[model samples]
Target: MSEVASEVIREMKREFKVVGKSVPRRDGIGHVTGKTVYVDDISFPGMLHLKMVRSPIHHGIIRNVDFSEAEKVPGFVRVLTHRDVPKNIYTILCLIGVGPDEEPVLAVDRVLYKGEPIAAIVAETEEAAMEAVSRVKLDLEELPAVFDVEEALKPDAPILKPWGTNYFIYEGHHCRRVRFGDVEKGFAQADYIIEEVYNTSPIEHAPTETTACVAKPEPDGRYTVYTNTQALFFTMDNTALILQVPFSKLHFVGGTVGGGFGGKVDVITEPIATLAAMKTGRPVKFKYTREEEMRVSSTRSAWRMYFKDGVMKDGRIIARKVISYADSGAYNRHTPYAVTKHAANIAGPYTIPNVYIDAYCVYTNRQPASAMRGFGVTPASFAVECQMDKIAETIGMDPWEIRFINAYRNGDMRPHQKVVEDATLIEVMKAAAELVGHKLPEHLLKMHSWDREKA
Candidate 1:
């Protein structure tokens, strides 16, 4: 072996403590014995249970809100509307320079999706909270609703977003766009062009533990919050910002989570519970039931991706254009960022010479989408990988052969003009072919990441 390769292996071995060895997991025993202190496992004294009064309409203008019946419910402590929230509006990604916090923690003048939180009730018991939440009356004027992004983008379609547009603005651009090289010329020079569209519906996180939080008022004036949030500091910052309180005033006592999978990334239940605790001077606990978790919680945005590719008979992708829409449901939770990521990665792990992409985070009359395992990139990969088979079928080439032919190599330019370095696509594909015993033509079998395909 070459000295450099040998040194790399040595370095890799040094970096790993459990490689090729039967090392026991550190936390497996504790989990198996039921000793983990998940957020749901905790309890406090005099804690008020909370529930939300959600919107029933997909899109509507709120004419009136009545809590008279809710107030009469036994053990009903308080009901908070959008008016009660100090800073009613916040985007979950605002800390990362994502601007114009469009989503209200509570529905303000309008409801854009079914099951959107319009009011929160805090009571002495869970039943009381549920009863109070159910009794809160809303007078909503129904509006024309669109579920599809294409439909939502039509000139005559009803706008679901508060910004008067159905889509998120990315640095003044209507969609997250990426362009590089001469795509028109590449398409003109291609032997065959393939256009394909792929779609994925809203995916739920469906963790063992649904969204939950507990907020406790402390004697020192700093509120203690326990939640299963994926990002603690982000949640803390968002909660503090939404409540219009200093960040230091909120103390986060969390790290244990049942399962998040990026669904817990949003600052959902914590802010409301904290506000309720501050108002009532008592600990507030809020937990979404299985139904609420499935209905109201953010899911992976449904994506509709269109790909137009310029390819040679030999399987090299010369040019590509990806137009995709992430159905952001009613609000911009993390979907705008997901759009940017989709724009960046839509073309997948390929080194195309010419590329153009437009990714939109669109509002629709559905449950808002936040984050999941891969967030935006998984669906992109799904579309591209599925297209690989389509491309092979179109040109009568091997599926794996096509991947190796178009896979990224060292110093190959990407869609954004970033030259790929140390790419492993060719090697990984080669290994997969070997493992699966996929037979490739002799010429195609010789391809390598370090060298161009001569087949």
Candidate 2:
């Protein structure tokens, strides 16, 4: 280990006793013993089951929510249509201090994505509630759906959320752009220029447990919910707003999460469960199957990035420019922040003197994306790292040597003009190379051997 890293480690060890030790988890015993009181395991007296009636169309205008036929179903207690929901439009992410761009509670007047909730059914029996949903027909007028980000960006594309010029919630130019030194001049001084485009697709966390929420209405016209949520406090606040009740009336208890790699952060099943309970005046439990969870819940946004790099004959990186476009499916859940972060991280750890990057979040008719593991860094890393390899090839230099010459160090200024603090990229690179016993290519090695003999 480096002296600095060792010192930091020593300091951390001094500050904390269990820092290096593998201490047993607090919930480990119950988890292994099967004694943990998970929400799905909890059953309440007179608790009713709930089921949602989701939109089958990708994009459509909700002409009507007819729940009259469902009221005749045996064991059916209460039904909640879009009209029954509050006017306040909010998302689970916004409620928890993520970002704005929430949709109307329940698909009000319009459904932007397939599997979006249009109405919910509540009943005495779980089977009855499931059957009751089929009776609650949603009359929807299909609108032109945008399945692709490129298509959505087209001038003639039907705007999903018409607030901005396009369907997306544009965070203005400041969020879309990044600049450093004069990129044009840097490229002009370069001996070689290379560019490549990288594509990434949406992926789900796919936790073993699907989304589930149980809500019980209190006598004081409030509801308490137990569900799988990463941000409990945020869910409570948003649920209260959606229910049109005081904050005190809504209580949230995050269950022992089976798993949520940023997927459970959104308020997917909670609002539906709360709505069902409130309407029925009885406790309601809603559990989503794997298929339903994947269909309706958000996932990581897909990214397409084009990287252009200018390199000197000696393999020194001079400039870099990246243009990234993110497919923010359906609602503007957290695309602005996602796109901004993607743009900021385009230059990676390379020490390019000039850099320019643009990231766009275009709306599409699919599940809205939220934060995922690694956030926007993975795509940016892949593009820049691959480009770095290409630059090495053109200059006939060792890839490691090229990286060592251009990799940013602590206190180095990045393309965004942000000074990096305590960066260990060089140390990490060398250590990794040494550990792997990296060797030069055959051609380079042969050339070097010939040069040595000549010398």
Candidate 3:
């Protein structure tokens, strides 16, 4: 539990049903016996299977999409392309005021990545749908693709997004920015400065159950969907917006998920399956194949971070600056918000007087990335903690001493001017250092979290 949660529990003092007590899993027996019904386990009498015709090239211009051969295949029902969708553009995070709807349900004029879905093929059987999708022809004009975040931000790099720039607009700014005190003055006053760079590649969620959804059109003119999505309201609202229908027209059934880890929150499968069901007036089932799940699904973003620190000889962090780039892949899935969150934590938990931060969410010609556990702040935390150790090594000071000296206190101010209160960094560090039997100087060991004067 977090420090604030523990504090809140102590204040409540009346809770005894579940707090701080061991509880049995409610669905353990059903899960162990394989009696729980998943989306794939449910079937309908007139259900049609859906398969996607994914792009084979990374970046391209669509000269033509020829489905003549696909139409001739036996049991072929129909196709859902960009033209069929009510609204071809949307952002998964738009409902939370994060976007201008930057993603397309189906590829319109061109595709941005190798696995971009260009069309959906529906048929009486899943095998027939797959065969039809494989037979669909694509006439594409390949364009040079940019893979690196730094290169994508360069002036000469090819523009991948329709925004005519590789980065998202954070209130008309080039990047999400943080400005506090003067970093130049901080550097001038410091006894020494430390600098380091860190990089991380994209990470896939790879849940045990791949993304799947089944949509059934009801007699009341509403669509009922069964999915494993972690967020139900997102599925309902996004699916309705993509279909250009009212919110009352969609119903979601979920909450029993195999595993999410922040990935299943994506509203990818429900919107298209709902459209297919409405088009055919029959139930539609769409389940991502293992290959599709791995290749086309959103993953954790690749991050490149640059850290600079100014410190005193007495183990005090005086100033800090961070410049981070979030590789958002072909679309701004959730990187814009992630970048903002990353920028907010540029100063970490230390009480630094001067700080400057510029965090960019850059686009690349790869599969669009999205949320995971700690979606935005994890990478920043990794860099911050690692740099603390490096700073100790350079200044010949114990890391615990350095942390104790600058840990946030009640009166300390964040880069955004929010006052820190009840910060436990000092207490946690001392306890952790003791756990490893790492000794520190007596003066530093005397520090406490509640000691605002020492902080």
Candidate 4:
């Protein structure tokens, strides 16, 4: 190994005590022994089970919702509709200044997508809740639904939002945009222009323990919510806002999660369950069935990315213009923020002189998309790496050489204008090549992240 490589290893070892070492997982034993208590495992005495009555049609105006049959069901306690929610309109990102409260706690007036919750049926038993939910009568006027991201943007497209646009407005712009240098000039100077479109489907988190919460009304008029939410504080605050109560009136108990994978971050169950508990003066437990978990929960947004790259014969990428559309589905969950992150990263780690990105968080008549593992950046990385391979094929150069030529070094400016610091892509790539038995030439091997002169 070179001296620099040895020094890097020494530095890593010095900075990270756990690096290259195995430590026993703190929760491993409890998990294996079935001693771990998930939110669904806990129940309160005289607790009411909550089941959602959802929309069957993808797009529709709810002409009427009759819960008389549901109320007639044995063990049915009460049905909570949008009217019952103190402040029904809520957006999970409201805490971060991201919305005008787009999502309804229980959908009002109309249902935007199939499986959108219209009413919460609380009953003495889970079976009773399910039966009551099934018995609720809905009269809906079906509307033409647009599922494609591009189709939703057309002038004739069914406008999903009240502001009269299918896409999120970014400070008066139609999309989140980033411009570094003059992309047109770079393309004019290039030998080749490689253009391709990439598409991705929404992915469900499908955690072993589905989205669940148990809300109990305290004797002191406060509410205690036991949930599997990954964002405990966020859920509490949002729930308080939805309930129109002081933040101090809510106590969120969490920390044990079967699996989140970014799905549990959305404030879905806590507010409504707590409201149900408050109205009935009894604890309310809301849990998604396996099918409900798969069908109704928020997912990683589907993406359509168009990449047009200006490349040199020697394999340096001079400019990249990326137009990306993220299907945020019926509501804005975390996708508005995700699109901003996507705009910053869609160009990847390469240091192109000129880069342009326009990322849109679009509304469609599908289930709302939210956070998953690396919601904004993972899809971009996939597209970028694939585009890199395409560029290598077009220029007749080694993929490794192409990457090393364009890899951003420390002190480089990202397209978002953030100063790159502590970048390790080049070094990590070198080590990865060796581990995979791919022999890189000396020129590529000598490249380091710290100094551009070495390249």
Candidate 5:
């Protein structure tokens, strides 16, 4: 190996000491034996339970909200509307560093999606609070709704967030272009060109523990919240910002998380519980039903991709282009970063000379998409890999061989013009192919069959 390669390997092995070591999990026994205290186990003296009232229409103007009947409920404490929430808009995935126009603590004047929170109620009991939430009267003037990104981009479509256009956030002014060689010359030298469109559906996080949080106000004028959150720091930041309180005055504790899978990264039930506690000056607990959890929370974005590739007679790749539209439903959340990552990774693990991509993060009337396991790379890979197989078939080559020949190597520039240094992608691909016995099949046949006659 070269000196540089040797040094890189040494450093990698040095960093691998703790990479795959099997240590006893911190919460193994507590988690399996149900001895751990989760957010749902929290209860405080003189505490109230909270419930939110959401919009039933996909898009509408809020005409009126009446809390008189809710106040008459058996043990109702208070009914909160947008008027009660502070006038501040927040981005749920502000860590990606986008503007504040993406999301808000509560729906201010209009309801863009079917289950957006419009009002909330607190009572001595969860059932009573839910009853009061159901009793609250809301008058909405329904507006025409657009559920698709293409429809939302139309000139005549209704604006989901009137202050902001349907476009959530552009990646950067000119972040979508990547080129290595003369694309016109490369395509002129190509023997064949192929194009395909692919679609991927949105999926849920479906964490074992649904949304739940408990907020307790201390006698010293400080608040502590227990929640099922992935990052305690981000949740603390969101709570402090939303409540207009100092970070020092807020204390956030994450319990043994049942499962996150990138879903528990947002301020959902915690903010609602905090609002109830702050308003009532007492501890408050809020938990979401499975249906409510599905309706109000974010999920993975649906993708529609158009991919094109130019290949030589010997299966060398020349050029590529990808155009994608992502559904950033109801809120911007992580759509900006997600779309940018998709744009950057559109070429997959290939050494394409010319690459161009345009991705739209358009708003629609559904749940806003947040981070998932792959965090926007999976959809791009799905399209590109399928296209790679198609290109291989056209040029009489195996998919694995084509990918191996075009895979990134040391000093190779990626689709976004980033230089690869001492990469192990080729080695990993070789190991994977060896382990999986890579081959193309000529016919579909059952690989395993049960033999009842032997018994």
Candidate 6:
């Protein structure tokens, strides 16, 4: 361990018993011994399996749906369509007062993306449910679809949202906007202008265990839900609102999730399964098959970022302008919030006098994108670091020297108007150089995060 870190740990150990001590994990034994209980491990008597009939095309108007053959299946219990849902339209962030409730519990009239659920089939067995779902027929009229973020924003782009725009509306603005100083003046005064575009594809979580839930109707006039959801109260509350039932009537049980990585936070599979149990007075299990988990479940949104930086010959950045677009796919699951975060972070950690950023949460004919590990910030960091490297190369300066010169200090102000209080970029970089066996120049070695005047 580094001397500084070791000293800090020793100081903390004097005040706290657990600090600097090895601790045993409470759940490690259960996990290693295979005794840990997961949502799919629990089953009840008279349980029914639920499967969905999804849209085959990316964008289409539903012409007709025929379930006659599906009803003939031997163990077919019943089917739930949009009509069966108590409240059809929902936005996952509605609890936080975010939205126009753009997503449907079950798609009606049209399907915006492939794998969008149109109907759900319940049967005595999983195989029977799968068969019934396959037997159901759908007549859809295909429509033009847009996948590219830039293409979706063009004037000639096919409209996707009901609000007649391909992007999420942020407070009367088309995109989240951040401005601090005069970027044009700074750019004109700079010696060189560096511009680059960075693009990232959508990424799937693909947890070891797929999303699953079991809702059972209790004899005491309440419902019990066994779920793998990362958010228990959030899911229960949203499920209650979707089912139009009192919150007191639902009990959500969640623990031992195989893996989430921000994937299982969305409130899917619980409400519909609970409703099925309510209608039939029996337990209903809704589990996403591997195919459904991979193809239909929410993934990290794809991002396209355009970065333009103005720098002097001495390795100091004077201005930065970033235009970022996040492809939120068909619905507003969690991408709106993610875009807001992206807008705040795309400026990066460096302190520039003039900064301007516009980040848009765009919609396209693809599977809806939601959260992943560092959903919004990770992409921005990737683009920002790459842009930093490009700037260093163009200015004929060492990358570390450039970073050390522009690194934000403790009292620096960010583009978002927040004062940086505890920044340690210089110190951390120095420690990293030491650990990696790289010798920084004397001037760079003397730089500290507390005071930038030394640099």
Q: Would you estimate the TM-scores of all the predictions?
A: 0.95, 0.89, 0.95, 0.97, 0.89, 0.97
Report clashes for each candidate as comma-separated counts: 0, 0, 0, 0, 0, 0
RMSD of candidates 1 onward, in order = 2.2, 5.2, 2.9, 1.7, 8.0, 1.5
Question: What is the C-alpha lDDT profile of model 3 across 54-153, one tens digit per residue?
Answer: 9899999888999999999999999999999998899988888988788889998988888999999999999999999989999999999999999998
Q: TM-score for model 4?
A: 0.97
User: Under the 3 Å rule for N, CA and C atoms, how many clashes does model 3 have?
Assistant: 0
Candidate 5 pairs with clashing backbones: none
Summarize candidate 4's per-residue lDDT along 1-455 as a digit string, tens digits. Answer: 68998999998888886887688999999999999889999998999999999999999999999999999999999999999999999888989998877899998999999999999999999999999989999999999999999999999999999888999999899999999999999999999999999999999999999999999999999989999999999999999999999999989999999899999999999999999999999999999999989998999999999999999998889999999999999999999999999999999999999999999999999999999999989999999999999999998998888999999999999999999999999989988998999999988877789988632
Candidate 2, 1-455: lDDT as tens digits: 56998999988887886878788899999999999877788678999987788889999998887788888989998877667776447755554354454586677788888888777778898888878888887788999988877787788898776564443444445238888898889889989888888888898888888878899888877778998887787777777767777888887887589888888877667876887776777788988878887887788889888888888887778888888888778876666667777877888877788998778877788888777876677777877788878878878987877876676766678877788776666667656766899754443333211111222
User: Per-residue alpha-carbon lDDT of model 6 for 184-245, expressed as tens digits?
Assistant: 99999999999999999999999999999999998899999999998899999999999999
**For residues 140-245, what per-residue lDDT tens digits would candidate 1 score against the true structure?**
9999899999999999999766578989988888999998888899999999899999999998988888889899999999999988888899999999999999
Q: Tell me how far the alpha carbon of residue 323 in candidate 3 is from the true structure, in angstroms, after superposition.
A: 0.8
Native-to-model Cα distance after best TM-score fit, residue 351 in candidate 5, in Å: 1.2
Error at 253, model 5, angstroms: 0.4
Looking at model 3, which ten-residue stretch has the lowest summed lDDT?
446-455
User: How close to the true structure is residue 308 of candidate 1, measured as C-alpha lDDT?
Assistant: 94
Assess candidate 2 and give its lDDT: 0.77
